[model samples]
Target chain A: MTIKVAILGFGTVGEGVWETLHTHHEYIQKKLSTPIEITSILVKDSNKKRNLPDSVQVTTDIEEVFQQPVDVVLEAIVGKQPAYQYVTRAIEHGAHVITANKEMFAHYGPHLLELAKEHNVWIGYEATTAGGTPVIRTIDQMLQVNQIKSIQGIVNGTSNYILTQMTKHQNSFEDALLAAQQKGYAEADPSNDVDGYDAFYKAMILSQLAYQDQPNWDEVYLEGIRTISSQDIDKATIQGQKWKHVATIELRHGAPRASIQPMQLNEDHPLYNIDGVENALSIQTDLLGSITLSGPGAGKLPTASAMIEDLLYVFQKERQQEAQYV
Target chain B: MTIKVAILGFGTVGEGVWETLHTHHEYIQKKLSTPIEITSILVKDSNKKRNLPDSVQVTTDIEEVFQQPVDVVLEAIVGKQPAYQYVTRAIEHGAHVITANKEMFAHYGPHLLELAKEHNVWIGYEATTAGGTPVIRTIDQMLQVNQIKSIQGIVNGTSNYILTQMTKHQNSFEDALLAAQQKGYAEADPSNDVDGYDAFYKAMILSQLAYQDQPNWDEVYLEGIRTISSQDIDKATIQGQKWKHVATIELRHGAPRASIQPMQLNEDHPLYNIDGVENALSIQTDLLGSITLSGPGAGKLPTASAMIEDLLYVFQKERQQEAQYV
Candidate 1:
């Protein structure tokens, strides 16, 4: 048997997914006992020059991609608009959906999950939060036995990279952001990252998973790192501290409260040394003490790796179900 | 339906499991949709005073505990002899087994896994490796997509605690070992922990999971922290380094080579800041670069938390299989 997958974008992450599948094709095939084939790729411009095999279908029409039965749909398109629509359609089509769109997942994740449950399909958004960190799976498993007391994370790599540059080089925030942009760590317009929107979205996703409820967007205190000055960094350095943009949510009075802001961390802090583009999540639970997971928060291959892992998980479940019937 | 559990050995970990189950009784019941009942507990002496309720059956003979049908068997016995025999019987009786016996697991895990597979039962040893860190689950998920290159861990909490004392107070190895024993972190005869056997066992477990193969015991170079002096600690500290009893396994030339020794870690290393009784595992993979998980290595609650998580996993899988037929 062969598993069919449809790609919803041919951007960096889409290309990454394709490349990863190609790179680890032999191992993946052996593990799944089924070859995975990209049956269709829905791109904005089908006429764009591409370096893919001619046998694979590249189409501009979503309907065309769904014409054939697709076991899975991988959506890597940015923003909420069509990505949400595409994901809903994928679930309706009885195909498991794996998405890397944080904006779409953060806003419509709960609703989509309900829809997936109704359709008896799975919706995987592991890449939507901290890329390659496996925090989503960790939280899901831990929630089975632990009441998470609190979560503190450096989820936005761009912001962390900027802060790291500022602390290490004594550079101003503007200078640091410019350096990040030059190094391709930050985008041309870095508001989503530096303004804390990216971290806020991830925090919302985590809150929903951890608490099974989320604080209203208005209730969250959102603060960006743009206001941080070099003097602040110097003073923090003198005090054996570093400035980090931390996304935090805690159960207060039996309700989850969340915030995203720049905070000074001492040397003893688990996330204090998580510098550069690295991300870290420190979870405190009632049973287990503070447990922290640190790794690459964002990148092409890392995000792709998360999506691939989700795909593998979907297949593993399928295999398990098949084994049960046999 | 109530899930029947038989606990073998009423030691520290067994007591912890009992306490954890009592503390989270309502929550676990809701999650599993079936209350977990400790139907039997095998102890060295049934006459020994225990704080458990009278409803639970405390037995001195293993056959008495197995007289009734047990859905799960939790083995907290420390040594290889009784634990290996009990685990084999449990699997043969078609019950899922969750064990905290590292020595038994490190030696016989592969064979027991094969036995469980033949019996169509599950065996969970999450607590056998890194307590409360979830490194086993993390590695399992990562292995689906990435080729793990290397693994470095501070797996033995007693050794880490002794080293942390020596580093912080410039205490002699003997003095630190004495302090650890006083704090109940080390045993009266601390050779298992201090001689690197505890870490060596965990390294073997990690190697088996990562490579699906184990290195010969004789091939592994095991060195303990017993030889380190206060002078070595001061010299390393002056050079911005710390001595860590690191358990490491790497894919060298397409085969795993493992070691447990005191290594000098620089400030930038991921495991450098792991102090006191904290445990950490840093894994280098092909696709995801390096990721680290750090938390409490061992304790009553932490180890119990791991066992409970494994129990939940067994129930979750059972639930999934049932859902398939439904």
Candidate 2:
């Protein structure tokens, strides 16, 4: 069976997914033992003068892309408007959905999950958290046997980039931020990443997965590394500590609470060694004790790799569902 | 639809699996939907004193345990000979297999995997590596999308225990080994662990999983920390390094080669921070870059947690297969 996929954005993640597919084409083909076609691409500008394959149908209208023949809608768009409509419509049309949009998943994950179930499909957002770390898959499987008590990690790459630059290059926050932008690690307006909103959204997604529900995103307080000075880095170094931007999801009593903040972690802490764009999650559980997973937080190949993982899962689930009918 | 199980060797891992089933009884019920029943146990002594429920039939003869009404065999036995016998027999009997035995799996993994496929059942060995870290599953799922380049980390707990003891107490190798034996971390013989055979087995298993075939274990060199001195530890410490029992599986050109030895790693290395009985694996892949998973590599609860993970995978596979057939 062929799994038809629609790329809802032509951004970094979307392009990376395309390039990865092109590079590891044969490997994935052999592994899946089934064909997965990227059917259509939804872009804001149809004539953007970008190189796209002749087989891929490019359209500016979201509905045009959503109405195309597809088994799964892959949303790589940045924010919530057309992405929300396109995804919902794809699900309503009975297509499976896979996305890297943390903002949408963070806000409407449970509702979307219910929608997917109601429509007899699956929604994947593994890339929404820690890029290609497999934290989501691990938690999903682990939760089947063990009760996850808490999740703590460095979930933001921009904040981590700044902190790492401060440590490695003796750069101040402004210098680090400028350098990150120059390196294309940070956006022109970097509030989303540097002000902890990015991490907060990821925390919300993780909380949903861990608790099987969403937390109040507004109530989850965030403290970004915007205030972290060169002096702070020196002080942390002198005190044998690391200034790490930590996103945490833990149970307060029986309810889940999440927060994003920069913490002074001692040398013994796992997050202390997680420098730069590396993401690490320490999952404390009832049955399994503490299991920590660390990997690249964000990159072209990494995030693209995550989408491919979801594709395999989607195919597996589809095969299983088809078997039920047989 | 109950999974009838026979546990080989009602020892630490077996009892832990049993107790875990009881501890998270309701959760397992909800997840499995169907239940699991332990039908028989093979032990060295029929008169061996162990707390057992009435429904659990105990046996002195290994062959007798395989003849019982068992659909899955949990081989918690710690050797190569009888474990290989029981697992091969169980597969021939059309039973699934889950084991925590590294040595057995390392030597005969590919053959058993083929046997399992021929018998249309799964052969699970998640607990063979880093216990509850979910390293194997992560590789099976996540790295399937990417090419795994190299695997390296601290895979042995006993060696780690002795090294950590040496670092913490400033004890010599012999003294630390004595302390580890006293703490039940090392065996009375200490040959398998301290002599690096245990780590060798783990590296062999890792090579099989990472390479999708059995590596020539005989071609791999082995080294232990039994020769490591306090002076080495002090030198490493002075150089801001930590001594760890590192097991490495590297693909040189095309073929796989592995090594298990005491390596002094600097702060830049992930294994530098993984001390004590904590085991860690760093999987460098083409797509996701580098991913590291760490957890309790040994102990009753942690190992049992891994077994439970295997049980969940088996259950999920069964469900998927059932869905296919219906």
Candidate 3:
């Protein structure tokens, strides 16, 4: 089966997905035992001077990509505007969706899930939560029999990187943030990451996947590391504690609530050791008491790797469903 | 669809499985959306006094559990002798099997998987590796889309518990092992854990799953915490490192080989910060780059929880397969 894919962005993650597909295309095809081809790419700039193959089509009209009869759409676009429209339209056109857009999923996940179910297609956003960690797929497939009660951890790589540098090198918050930005872990305006808003969005997405509903996003009580000084780090070290920026989504009786902040971690806590750009999550459940996953939360290849994972997931699931017809 | 289940070996993990069913039977039924009832239990001593419901039958004979009309058989036994026999018999009878025996699976996994496939029954051994951490399930589902290159981290609790104590309290290896035994984390002899045999067995199991065949288990290069002194711990601390008993399975060209020993983990390593009795694994893959999972590796309830997850997976896959008939 040849699975056709259309990419809807030409930014860092999109270029990463493109490069990965080109570099590892043969290896991936051999593993899946199926042929996969990227048919079209939609970019804001028609002439971005990217080193893409001339055989593939590049267009600014997002609708043309969805209309090209592609079996899957990969959304690497950041915001919720055109991403929402393109994703919903792709689902409406009977195409499976793979997205890394957390903003759209956080606000409209339930609705998008409903639409995909109605259209009989899979909707995957594994990259929306923790870059490349397989937490979403693990929870979705493995622990289906168990009830998830909470998901707590460091969900943002920028904040984690900043905080880790601040504690390890005793750097100030500004210096750490600048270092993260220089390393491309943070954006020019690091408000979304440093102020805990980025983690807040990820928490919202996690709550929806684990709890089947939207969490109280506004009541999440977001606290950033802007207030965390070197003195605070020294105090924590002296008191035998580790400072961690944690985003937690708790489910009590099926109602979901969340909190994103910096907390003093005890010596025995798992997150106490999770430093830098390494992201970690502790999932508390009724059956499996707690399972933690930690890894790089943000990287070009890691983020693109997650998208490819979701892409394969959609195609594999479609194959399983189609196998029933035979 | 009523799924009939039989319990094999009424021991710690077995009792935990039974207790879990009794306490969360309703939740399991609702989550699975099917009727599940324990029909029989195979015990070493049939007349042993224990708290169990009157509806379930107890027997010392393995044939009684396998020859009966059961849909699934849960094997919570720890050894290779009767577990292999009961699993083979259950598979021959075309019944789905769930096991928590790492030794048996590590030795005879391919044979069991082939037998199950021939009989059109599922063989689930999620608890055979890292208990309750969902390592097997994560690999089976998520990494299916990606190429797994290496799996490295702690896979045993007793050794980790002792090492963590030594690192935190600056205790000697012998004292830490004694403390672990006092806290019920280690056995009286403590040879299996302290000698790295337990971790070697788990690495074999992980290698089997990751590569679908057992690697050279004898060449695993086993080194336990017994050889790790406080001097090594202090050296690691001075070098900004942590002493963790790490089990590593490296896969190349689809062949998986493993080694379990103590390594001076770098500060930036994800497993470096994972302390105490916690077990963590870093799965380096083509997709999802480097995904890590950490949690309680062993305990009555945690191991049983992994067994239940396997059972649920078997049930769901059974349902999905059976739905094709309708």
Candidate 4:
């Protein structure tokens, strides 16, 4: 059996998914008891040169993807517009959906999940938060028995890189951000990361998952590292503290109160040592105390790795359902 | 529907499981789509005082537990003898089994998993290794795509506690051991922890999981923290290093090479800040780079939390199977 997969975008993460699926084809097939074939890839330009196999179809039309009997659709597009539409269409057509689009998922994930449930399909958005960290799965498991009291983490890699550079090298915020952009860690227009919108989106995703309820975005406090100065870094270092752009959410009175800000963390804090493009989440639960997971927050391979894990999960669930009939 | 469970040991973890289940009865039921009833508890001394509800039948005879319509059996026994036998028997009786017996599982887990597979039942031993860390599940997910290159961690809390005290307070190994025992972190024997056998077992379990092959017990190197002196700690501190009793397994040439020994880690190492009784694991994968998980490694509630999560997994799988039939 072959599982037909459609790629909604031909960006870095999409290209990574293609390469990894081909590179580990044998092992993945052995594990899933079925081979995965990239049936179609939707891109903005069909004339763009891509090093892809001849058998795979690369098209500019989204309808070409749905024309085939796609078993899964992976959305790697950045924003909400067509990614949400493509995901809902895939679910309606009886295909499972996996996405790395954080902006799309952070706002419409709950609704998409409900639609998938109604259609007896699955929606996986593990890459929408901290890439390759498995924080979503960890929280899902903990919620089985424990109440998540709080979640605190450094979720934005670009801001973290900027903060680490400013603290360690005594560079100004502008200089650090310039270095980050040159190193491909930040975009040219970095307001989404430096102004805390990126971390805010991730914090909302975590809050929704932990509380099973959407947070009031207006109520969530937001502060960015754009205002941090070189003197502030020196002051924090003198006090044995490190500045980290942290995303935090606490369950208070059965409601999730969340914020994204630059906080001075002591040496003993779980996320204190998480430096430069590394993400760490410290989750406090009633039954298990504190559990911290740290890893690569964002990268081409790491984000694609998360999406592949979700794909593997969808296949495993399908195998289980098939075994039930036998 | 109701799931019937029997626990075979009335120790700390068993008591914790009972208390947590009762404390969060409504929440657990809401998640599982069924209520779990502890129908019986197998204990050596039935007359011993236990603060348990009368509805739970405490029994001295193991046969009495199998006589009931048990769907799941939780084994919290300490050693290999009865745990292995009882687990095998439970599988033969067509019951899913979840165990916290590291010694038993480290040696006989593969055989029991095969037996459970033949009987079409599930086996969960999440508490056998690092308690409440979910390293086992994390490795399972990674195995779907990435090759686990290495696993390094402080899997034993007692040795870590001793090392922390030795480094921070300049205590001798004997004094640190005494302090650990007083703090209820070390057992009376202390051989399993201080002698590195406990960490050795956990390392073997991780090796088996990552490589799907048992490491030869004779080939695996093992060392304890008993030989570390105050002078060594002081010298390492001078060199800006700290001692950690780490369990490590590397997949070299498609085979697992395992070891448990004290290593001087630099400040930049992931496990350097893991002090006191906190446990930490750093997994190096090909696709996701390095991921580290740290949390409470051993305690009554933490260990029981792992078992409860496994129980929830089993129920979720059962629900999926039922849904497939519907």
**Candidate number achieving the greatest DockQ relative to the actual structure:** 1
lDDT score, candidate 4, position A16: 88
TM-score preference between candidates 2 and 4, better one: 4
lDDT of 4 by residue, A95-180 (tens): 99999988898989889989999998998888988998888888888888888999999999999999999998999999999999
lDDT of 3 by residue, A197-314 (tens): 8888888888888778766656668898888889999999999998889998887665888889999998767678787788888888776777888777877788888888778766
- What lDDT score goes with residue B5 in model 1? 97
- Per-residue alpha-carbon lDDT of candidate 1 for residues A1-326, written as tens digits (9 for 90 to 100): 79999999989999999999999999999889899999999998878899989878899889989998799999999999899999899999999999999899889998998999999999888898889889999988888889999999999999999999999999988899999999999999999999999999999999989998888889999999998999999999999999999999999998889999999999999999999999999999988888999999988898999999999999988898788889
How does model 1 score by TM-score?
0.98
lDDT tens string, model 3, B1-326? 68899999889889989998877788778767798889999999888898888888899988777666899899988778878988999988889899998888877888999999899888888887778888887876555556778889788888888878888899898888889988888888888888888888888877777777777766568888777889999998889888888888887566777778888888778787677677878888875677788777877787887888778777765566566466
- Poorest lDDT segment (10 consecutive residues) of candidate 2 chain A: A317-326
Considering the two chains of model 3, state its CAPRI-style docking category.
medium
DockQ of each: 0.86, 0.72, 0.54, 0.83
Q: Please, what is the TM-score per model?
A: 0.98, 0.97, 0.94, 0.98
Task: Write the number of the candidate with greater DockQ, choosing between 1 and 3.
Answer: 1
* Backbone clash numbers for all candidates listed: 0, 4, 0, 0
The sequence of per-residue lDDT tens digits that candidate 2 reaches over residues A1-326 is 77678888988999998888778888888877777788898888787898887988888887777666788887899887767888899899998888999988887788899999899888989999899888899899888888889899898887898899999889989999999999988999999999998898899889888998656767787898888888999999999898999988988878889888889999778678888878899999987898899999898889989988898787876665575466
**What residue runs in model 1 are displaced by over 4 Å at the alpha carbon?**
none
Which is better, 3 or 4, measured by DockQ?
4
lDDT value, residue A133 of candidate 4: 83
Judge candidate 1 against the unseen true structure and give its global Cα lDDT, from 0 to 1. 0.93
